[model samples]
Target: MLRLRRPNASLVLRALLVVVLAATSAAANEAEKAPPDLARGARLYSDNCGRCHNARGPAEYSDAHWPLIVTHMRVIAGLPGEQARTIEAFLRASNNPPPPPRRLGRLAAVVPAAGLSGSELIERYGCRGCHVIGDAGGSIGPSLRGLFERRQADWIRVQIQTPREHNAKTLMPLYGLSDAETSAILEALRAAR
Candidate 1:
């Protein structure tokens, strides 16, 4: 009579296999966990605005200009407040990122706000489709040369926040921005010249 015998497998080998499998599963579980707000913002930015908007530093534009540009992006990009906030955080983190602290100078670094420059915002939002900035840009909109010198900051802020409020025939659309964005855009415009 021939008896069937199971192939010999070491207990240690089986234990190792089980441990490896458990570790892999744990790693996967961690990845599946919810992303932080900044991560969400970065994902949202890549999906919605990264196509046109390039990266920049906080000093690229004044702290005053970040919000206005974001306002326009919020509308044109169709992002929700949570997503917008996340993107804003991501922008601030990337652009106006913190400077390494000085242990001796005791001088605080002036950092730009957490968002894109007005120029970047304009480019990303397709303002270039109509308006022109510096020597290059689009032709569909008005030329934005020395706009800060031509217009008062408050007036410029108002016009940007609500274009229709100033000119009924103006084709520029209202972006409904926060004060911070308006300030940033205006500051950027001031520096553009």
Candidate 2:
């Protein structure tokens, strides 16, 4: 027969309370710690997205409005799901309007030589860095504003095929282009005038 001295209810209660308090405090501390992947998230937003929209700034709309804007741009801009997400992250970081898609179209070849559009050539080799045409580009190279009027298609073709051969000191990089790309750029240049 066990004679239990009056239960030490106070001691048992105190021990339970200590355990509960310790667990709660630990959880709170963890919640207060820094968030993971903050730097990675920022880099991902910039490399794939900053060109099209501002990151982490004032947006014209509320958070609820962003999804609709993203949807429209993804389809119209031909962005893949991952790219769209990158753009979304950038826009969410700073509320900014997404850039519009560049306008491009193939020009009909008037002369016998087959070709790609001037716009296509520009986009393919990124010619905007060295040239400017009206409001379109920069000054890395000579302004080709009226290249069509100033140059012949055959001359342009030769230049595309081997720029250094024509001018050793030319700042233009040798694009190591195929005959087809040369023809296309020439055709587009001819059409530009």
Candidate 3:
């Protein structure tokens, strides 16, 4: 009688290892080929980081330091490897955003923040870049439809000046705006529809 021979354990084990390695390499290659989506990363960062404390500013850490920070947070926050890498990319990208129009010259960095109306202040600072102040703006942040009604004046003021004080971590850039600028921004937000 002819008998069927069983496959050798060593050969099976080697083949399994090869398959596993090939799969792993393919996954790594795919990840490398795909570009990190900054918008998705930003959303992920907002969702994950906000769950704990607050969002952190991209400029808070240097490019060299961002990887380490993201890795640590990834572990603590239990974020996936791909997501953590995306966040790192977003942070690094944000840390070095494109340059604005040089036509504004030296004074562009620090608008006088005086004699400007609330709406003017908002426009000057590009508040609409991240928040939907009224009918139009980016969707990155919450809509500033009813600011004063929702939050105390002091709280709003603090948020404008230093967001970290409230949430401990946030990607909101500190504009170092003066009292007048902050007040103007607060008023504009209050008047937002």
lDDT of 1: 0.58
User: What TM-score does prediction 2 earn?
Assistant: 0.38
Q: Please report, in order, the local distance difference test score of every candidate based on alpha carbons.
A: 0.58, 0.54, 0.71
- Residue by residue across 111-190, what tens digits does model 2's lDDT show? 22434555576554555534564455444356776887777767777777667678865545454556555656665555
Candidate 3, superposed: residue stretches over 4 Å from native: 1-18, 97-142, 146-170, 173-193
Error of 2 at 74 (Å): 32
Model 3 C-alpha RMSD to native? 9.2
The CA lDDT at 90 in model 1 is 52
**Candidate 1 residue lDDT tens string, 1-193:** 9999875578778888999999878865664474434434444555556556643333454446766777788888677755666566555543432453233222212223565776666554444444556665544356888787677777887787767689765645444555555665667666677
In lDDT terms, how accurate is model 2? 0.54
Give the lDDT of residue 84 in candidate 3.
86
On lDDT, the leading prediction is 3
What are the TM-scores, per candidate, against the unseen true structure?
0.40, 0.38, 0.49
RMSD of each: 13.5, 18.6, 9.2
**Candidate 3: global Cα-lDDT?**
0.71
